[model samples]
Target: MKIGYIRVSTAEQNTIRQEILLRDLGVDEIYIDKASGKSTDRPELKRMMEYVRYGDTVIVESISRFARNTKDLLELVDKLRQKEVEFVSKKEAIDTTTPTGVFMLTIFGAVAQLEREYILQRQNEGIAIAKSQGRYKGRKPIEHPDLKSTVVQWRAGEITATAAMKRLDMKPSTFYRKVKKF
Candidate 1:
């Protein structure tokens, strides 16, 4: 079976392009995750790992979609290898069943990791410069209808944290952080 995997970093991003491309390639199934590739904790990624079998091929749009760092990429590929599964990256033209592909994958994964590190370094430098110039305001606070009232209710035990978070359309972490500010 040829299984496809697609991912985008944020909820706002669409996976349609990756899905269409994978479908065009005639994959038997496609799993998608709209989460950061920085971690392997994504639900669809876990599902894809459990769903593959020996001799199955996992196709991804690119190596970066599969993993953010070389360590993670190699670890994932090694896991697939142990399961006798072949990995194919469309953009990279890598088929892990070949020795040459394995070699190229290592180099590509290193390059990708380096690229990410450089991006982070540049972003930090830019933020520092902006801050020194007194123009670096972080993200603006979100406003929601009755947000303060609802938070007060939650804090007073009139509503469950879960319910409050749902009402605010926020994750637990964000909700708790907001609670602290209130």
Candidate 2:
């Protein structure tokens, strides 16, 4: 069986290109994740791993799309290998069933990890510069329309705390914290 995996960094990013390529390759099933590859915590990725059987082939658009760092990439590949599954990366022309492909994967995985580290370093530097220049205001607070009324009602005993929390769509801890601020 051939299983395809497609991923994009955010929900807004399209998976069409990867999907089309995987479909063109005649994959039987496709799993997709619309989240960061920085971690291997994606739901679809986990599902695909568990779903694969022996003699199955896992097809990916690229190494970076599969994993953000060498450690994660290698670990995932090791898992697949243990299950007797093969890995194929379309962009890198890597097929882990061959010896040369395995060697190439290691080199590419290292390069991917290095690239991720550089990206993080540059992002941190940019943030530090922005902070020093007083341009970074940080994330804006969420404004809930009924929060004030709900908190007031909860405080005044007109509504139960649980009722107010339900109305505000907040957990007990969040409700109490906001109550303190108000």
129-176: candidate 1 lDDT, tens digit per residue: 999999999998877887899988987899998999888998988888
> Clashes in each model (backbone N, CA, C under 3 Å)?
0, 0
Q: For each candidate, what TM-score against the reference?
A: 0.87, 0.86
C-alpha local distance difference test of each model: 0.93, 0.94
TM-score, candidate 1, is: 0.87
Clash count for candidate 1 is 0
Candidate 2's TM-score reads: 0.86
Which digits, one per residue and each the tens of the lDDT, describe model 2 over residues 22-131? 99999999999999999999999999999999999999999999999988999999999999999999999999999999999999999988998999999999999999
Cα lDDT, model 1, residue 178: 78
